[model samples]
Target: MQDMLVRLLDLPDVSEEENKLFEKEGVVFKKPITPEKSIVVDWVGEHFSKNWADEALAAFASLPVNCFIAQREQEILGFACFESTAKNFFGPTGVLPHERGKGLGKILLIKSLRALKEMGYNYAVIGGVGPTSYYEKVVSAKIIEKSERGIYKNLLKHSK
Candidate 1:
């Protein structure tokens, strides 16, 4: 695990404004996730379930959904799974129990949304999340429609 400051210092061509953000946030990172790293996913599966692991891995392999983990000391405290479907769509996010309530989840969410925005995804829709939860309340996610939809099935749209 490398410190965020160490990683930030290793970066090159950082602009003055970017440097300020780094100074303010005390961190900066934009590197792609390494598929080989299994620690983060491993913890997720062990704590959540094997089903969650399989789903997360499949989503990572898919084009629209990207899995990202944040490591401040090589220890992934949290992660997010953002998706696209050739159109706007909602995404899913998960945080390790050991790292919750520290605002890390929010950071992970911000990173995921920023990545989606960069990928041209506009609207994000999330469902099946607890109806009365902090996610919907603080994150501004709204429940649009609900019927027989399995929820997860509609996360990423396929080009058929």
Candidate 2:
């Protein structure tokens, strides 16, 4: 098995100001979901295509999930949603627009992995991810499947 890190710990210790900013003004950590807050969730679907939003929302709703919101004083910085499959596997993971490349992605990804492992999943697989090689380096994800989307290549993974 590739030493793919399926089980991980990604909780970041928030700086006091960041904690206060989130606590008193906005959401800092993971919390329960409600439709009201859904409006605040920004997916880059508009960039990819208007339909991307619905697709992302649909996938998030279909699985066992926990949504994380990162805001600083009521301004939404980023968010990530995690979903688990029947075999204790974690499926689709997403980060909102304006949040890419920040340390938050890595944090949420690790935390989600850790949670799935705790739920008794031995591995986690992700499909429809672009630039699979990038994730492979950061999280030790091994590609188990691949597909083509026009000129783009999509990768699937089975992580340890």
Candidate 3:
């Protein structure tokens, strides 16, 4: 997959979407605290992959933590993280299979992108995109040409 570039200044405000999700679905978005790092990372591993869990662990190393999560009370529904694989990069986000199509992915995405904007990035890369159209539709992300062999090109595959 190719990487996509997002113009941070062009992102839409998602406050209303967030409010609606909470009022209707009871899901709340939050940045996980230091004490909750292990729980969050483990959840990512169990639901996604060990690689994602590793990246989530890296997010915790930041002062305020570069990870954001969608949860309903004690259960985490989804997560998004940035600055874990590279600077000014947004990614490693995923929602539970059953919880998708509820706007949680989009909300988590915008929250992370907004965080990148706050950090002074005019543009952010959505590395190795899985849903190109989704990124384009949500954040006006454009494909970064010649980025097929982007940052993860040399990634080591897990042994079977």
Candidate 4:
């Protein structure tokens, strides 16, 4: 997959979406605290991939934690992690299959990109992008040409 670039300065406000999601669906978006680390990481592994769980672990290295989660009641609906695999990189985000189509993914993406902007970055890389059109339409992200492999060019894999 190729990488995409987003102008963090142009991120759309998602506060209303977040509030609506909670008011209507009981889903709340927030950053995870240290106490929730293991649960969050394990959830990511169970629902996504072990590599993503590892990236989620890296997110915990930063103060205040650089991970955002969508939760309803006590269950995690989705998550987005940044500054994990690399600084100023927005990615490794996903929503539960059943929870999609409710704009949760877009909300999570913007929330994470907004975090990067607050950190003084003008643009954020959606490294190893899988949904080119989604990123393009949601945030007006531009494709980074010749970045087919991008930062994951040297990504390690398990031996079969």
Candidate 5:
């Protein structure tokens, strides 16, 4: 998989509209505090992958903790994190399978990207991208040429 680049300054302002939709569905977007770290990590592990959970753990330790969550009356529906696997990286985001298409993913993504922009980043690298069209449509992300395998080249594999 190739990496993609997003010009943070060119991102569209969709948080406001997305927030309204989220509020209507009783979903709240927020950054996890110290006490909520374990809860968020556990949820990510269960709903996404252990790899993402590990990345979320790293995000929790960052200077400003570049991660966000979507919850409704206490249950986590989605999460997005940046500067976890690497600095100026936006990734490891996912929404629960059952909760897909509710716009939670987009909201979480925009919120996280906005945070990156606020952190003085002019661009963000969406490393090892999965859904190319989705990222392109949402943030105008462009593929970094000849970047197949990007930073995951030496990733270890488990033996069966």
Candidate 6:
């Protein structure tokens, strides 16, 4: 899949929708604290992949931390990270398979993109997108022309 670009300035207001999910599902959203890093990484590794876990670790190294997570009653349900795979980049996000229909992924995505905007970025790149339709519908993201593989053009795969 190709990478997508999000114009941060044109993002729709997500607070109301996010708050509704929070109230109805009791899910909380926030950046993982230093003490929660290892737990978050381990969760990502188990549910997603080790590579994404490593990127989450890099996000923690940033001053304000570039990752956001969704949890309910102290159990993580999903996560999203930016400025990990690349600067002004949003991704490596995933929601638990069981929680797919809820708005958790949307919350995590917009929260991270908003964070990037607050960091002075007018636009954010979502590298190597998987759910293209989701991004397009939620943030009006558009695919970057001829950017299939994009920054991961020469990515090395692990030998099994």
TM-score of each: 0.61, 0.56, 0.97, 0.96, 0.93, 0.95
Q: 12-104, model 3: which lDDT tens digit per residue?
A: 988999999899989999999999999999999999888889999999999799999999989999999999989999989999999999999
Candidate number with greatest lDDT: 3
Candidate that scores best on TM-score: 3
Indicate the TM-score of model 4: 0.96
Question: Per-residue lDDT of 1-160 in model 5, one digit per residue for the tens?
Answer: 8899999887777767677867688888888888888999989887777778889999989766789998899889889999899989998899888989878888888888989999999999998997699999989999999988677788764333
- Candidate that beats the other on lDDT, 4 or 6, i.e. the better one: 4
Rate residue 91 of model 3 by lDDT: 80
Candidate 2 on 1-160: residue-level lDDT in tens?
A: 1212242444334355455544565546554355524553344243343333443364356434344545555554554444522233333444555656655556556555666666666666554465677567667776653233421233232232
> After superposition, which runs of candidate 4 have C-alpha atoms over 4 Å from their true positions?
158-160
* Per-residue lDDT of candidate 6, residues 73-115 (tens digit): 8899999999998899998899999999888888889899989
Model 1 deviation from native, Cα RMSD in Å = 10.7
lDDT of each: 0.49, 0.48, 0.93, 0.92, 0.86, 0.90
Clashes in predicted model 3: 0
Q: 64-153 in candidate 4: lDDT tens per residue?
A: 899999999999999999999998998799899999999999999999999999999999999998769998888999999999977799
Steric clashes per prediction: 3, 1, 0, 0, 0, 0
Model 3 reaches what TM-score against the true structure?
0.97
Candidates 2 and 3 compared by lDDT, better number: 3
lDDT of 6: 0.90
Worst 10 residues of 4 by lDDT: 151-160
Candidate 3 clashing pairs, residues 3+ apart or interchain: none
Off by over 4 Å in 2: 1-27, 41-52, 55-65, 84-100, 146-160
**lDDT digits (tens) for residues 1-160 of candidate 1:** 0000011111223245445544654434332355533664576676665555555565556554476654554555556665532223333456667757656556556556566566665555443454435554445554544433544554553333
